[model samples]
Target: MKGWKNPILLVLGIGVSNIGNWIYFVAINLLVLKLTGSAAAIAGLFIIRPLAILFTNTWAGSVIDRVNKRRLMVYIDILRGILIAIIPFFNSIVPIYIIMFLTNIAGAFFGPTSETYITKLVPPEKRKRFNSIFSFATSGAMLVGPSVSGVLIMYGSINTSIYINAVTFFFCALAIFFLPDVDEKLSSEKVRERITMKTIAEDWKAVISFGKTATGFMIIFLMFQFITLISFSLDSQEVTFIQQVIGLSEKNYGLLVSLTGAGYVAGSLAVSALANRLSIRMLLGMGSFLSVTGYLMFYLASPQTIPLAVVGFIIIGFFSPFSFTGYATFFQNNVPVDLMGRFSSSFAFFQAMVQILLTLLLGYIAEVVTLQTVTVAFSAIGLLLAAALMSLIFLQSKKALFILEAENNLTEEG
Candidate 1:
């Protein structure tokens, strides 16, 4: 806590970028909807994103593990700024899709690389608290961004909103420039020893070997990721379910989405303020349990009692901070700095793979079955999965904790 200025400033920078990302997200969806007038185009975004991540993460991890992560972060942000700026100029839908896909490739690398930088910046003991703060910042953006984008599109202009998003990325890059770069938490000699001439395949083999030694931790991590994957299905089908199934108008549905965001913001702030007091286990346990409850609440709601749907979504949003707080702590505390890049990206890659398959499968299911039926059915699956996830986290994690500690000790002593 002695010199917290830099990390706090960095968090502010991240918050700006997070808000901008969400703004662009909403704006682009509206843009596409206007251009093509097709719900399918909006859904195509989910497909385009994970596909980009799948291809990029296959090799991004290996490069991230070897490179200077700070410099990588700088370059990616600058390029992202450029990419967002380019989007406004494209008149054709095809060009927009291509640019969006390229932008995603940059984002895929930026995700784990920034995480690696944070590991080197924040100490292990404070990571849970830090994660809580960071998660709160992002949730706040999720709360604000879409509403702002709507106002901009309605009153101002979509082009103006896109330019604002572009500017935020440039500001983010500028803010990150001030933070001093620490290549690794390890000593210079240790980092030098880690640097190798290995090919991508060999670096991945190293990653595979490390994963084998702590299979239990990896399993826990993947379960958390899988839970997240199932949660995303709601986002993809939300509009259709609300309009077609529940018979809400477009404006009313937007209000419901805003309400969900409000619930999320409140939940995030609650955990952020109490992060110092809550243990990681408590966060994860409560989060996992409530997520299932939220899913079931919405699933079980009668079409006439749609307010219950609001309550359900709010419950899910409120628990967002706690689950992510536990997840970030679990990763930062357990994973060694030397292998953090590959480990995090490998997890991302696996998560992306599941998301791709699930998104496709769930989309197909929604088309065949009624959207409402698919929503509730998937919620049933999420409920069971959440129960299993909670059990794994709470019931049988002693051995996993020991393995993680052993691995951490080895990295530190190396």
Candidate 2:
């Protein structure tokens, strides 16, 4: 526990920020609806986040890799806090959207920067446990944040919730300020290189070169990303599917969401407790396969089998942390820490682009075809991808990748 002080602090900081993010999510939707009285306006808020990611990630990596990540994280959090704090002052929808866009742009940069920082801070042997604890914090926020927002809005106002969220970001910045500067030893020239068009181009080339040279890693990465894309597409339709197809009430849906959060929290705790017991391959392969099966169970369930759907949700939520933590550990151990930011951002850029396209396509298809049919088809696709991912994960030739000590030794030898 003594050895975990800094990592634990890092987790707490992230957890606080996540709670604020969710609170802002609910408040912003209501605020947009109040201002414009249009569902489209609220929907536009959703588009702004991924659009911001697309706009920023192309060059964000160049800056992320060259800067002191800890300082960059502090600045980004403060910037987001300021942007969110002023959101309540905007009576017009356009201005609010503009502010939200800028805030998300800051968020886009922060994601990769934080990932790189985490990789540098947490030792390889401890990442699985660290990530499990991180997952627990995130899942707890998922449960608590919205409920807190509801209370704030009910007792106070939407503005109150927004202001509180802004404060959380500032709190996150403060927490980040206390973190050690892991980049202190990095070469001065590397850190001082001004971000230029040429630097950005070279970073992209380096990412491409890594992808070509490390085909297995890229394949696993993309397959896992595709599975996530499926999950996101399914989530976008979850409300409609539960209400219309499964004949569940809004209250039931809310309860189900709460249950999912509980499941995630429980699963994260289990992973943390059993971190040393479970191998990375088992966590990645079995965890993902079972999660997909849960999705399958839910999708195939009827109104008469609502309990089955409930169980399915629990299963998916519980096992998802296993897959996520496993992948984070795998990624941190495998990717060079120096290139972590660029690799994360570059892949995220493509993932965001595909997510936008896939989400739109799923929405359209659900309208054209039956929602049930579309969801089932996508879930089946997810199952196939998970199976393939598991197969790749357990391959003998790739076994070294999942073993941290062996991989580190191999890297040293190379």
Top candidate when judged by lDDT against the true structure? 2
Compose the digit string of candidate 2's lDDT tens values, residues 8-38.
Answer: 9899898999999889888998998999999
Instruction: Kindly report the root-mean-square deviation of model 2 from the true structure over all alpha carbons.
Output: 2.0
TM-score of 1: 0.90
User: Quick one: best TM-score, which candidate?
Assistant: 2
Q: Give every collision pair in model 2.
A: none
Please give the distance, in angstroms, between residue 9's alpha carbon in candidate 2 and its true position after superposition: 0.8
Distance (Å) between predicted and true CA of 140, model 1? 1.3
lDDT of each candidate versus the true structure: 0.78, 0.88
1-414 per-residue lDDT for model 1 (tens digits): 676787887899879988888888889988999899998888787678788888888778777776778778888889989988988888778999998899899989988988888988876666767888898899888877877887888898888788889888888888888888877454554445443446567767877897788776777776777778888866677777777777789998878877777877887788878977786777876787786678778766767989888888888888877888877877776677778888777767778887777877888998898777887888888778778877776676544442222122232210
Identify the runs in model 2 with alpha carbons over 4 angstroms from their true place.
Answer: 397-414
